[model samples]
Target: MTITALRTPRRLVRVRKAVTRRFARALTGDAGMSTVEYAVGTIAAAAFGAVLYTVVSGDSIPDALGGIIERALNTRV
Candidate 1:
């Protein structure tokens, strides 16, 4: 159509791009990344502690692993 009509669409596109860039920059910066990493590490540590408790309690561990340890204990070499 006319140049004035085209200007509106171009300005809207520029605004959308600017907002998206700011949102992306906020997520990729160090603060957000570090928080995500800390959350993942905390979850991993909790999972490891739960599994350690299960193994130590020995209520229902895997048969093959139990057999291996028993064999190792009984043998010299």
Candidate 2:
């Protein structure tokens, strides 16, 4: 194998070790990280679930929203 190819894996391993150490330290130092992660993940999952529910229900929310906007714009005071 070429020098570049042989050295790539070694370099990647060292970088991975460094990253893992840092992540471990950060997790230990930050007591609220787990809670923050859970909150963010829950919010993301809920958003995804809502979108999936809307799609699976065959509801055209975007179209309905657009129609409402168009109606409001076309209506006179």
Candidate 3:
């Protein structure tokens, strides 16, 4: 209808295209995780696994589980 209204949509389209291009460039610019990041992540995962293993292998958990099982089995009903 009006010249301003027609120009407004064109301006919006240009702005949207520019923003999309910048976003795409940002996403594809990096080649993903670097070697140092991978190494650090692996080390962190190994440490977490070691801690988890230590916790699960400790006596308290197994003893608790065994107690629960024994009680359930010995229930009169």
Candidate 4:
């Protein structure tokens, strides 16, 4: 390609400026959540964690885990 082809012209410069302005506005725009959204997200995450913890530490899980450990310890290794 020629050097002129690689060089940006006025139209390309205008286009680049437009795109940069658009991107700037988009970045600074309210595309994210407010404080209430953050609070809600935190609460949801905490609730999900609690549920996971409850399911993992349930009676059947503990019994199964204790049986595995007991067998492992009693094995004549």
- Which predicted model would earn the best lDDT? 3
lDDT of 1 at 23: 97
Model 1: pairs clashing at backbone N, Cα or C within 3 Å: none
Candidate 4 per-residue lDDT, tens place, 45-76, comes to 99999999998988988899999999999999
Answer with 1 or 3, whichever has the higher TM-score: 3
Q: Against the true structure, candidate 2 has what lDDT? A: 0.90
Among these predictions, the greatest TM-score belongs to: 3
- Best-to-worst ranking by lDDT: 3, 4, 2, 1
TM-score of 4: 0.52
Instruction: Name the regions of candidate 4 deviating beyond 4 angstroms.
Output: 1-15, 22-33
User: Which lDDT values do the candidates have, in the order given?
Assistant: 0.88, 0.90, 0.96, 0.93
Candidate 1 local lDDT, 1-77, one digit each (tens): 89999999999999999999999998988754477788999999999999899897774667767888999999986
Error of model 2, residue 39, in angstroms: 30
Show pairs that collide, candidate 3.
none
Clashing pairs in 4: none
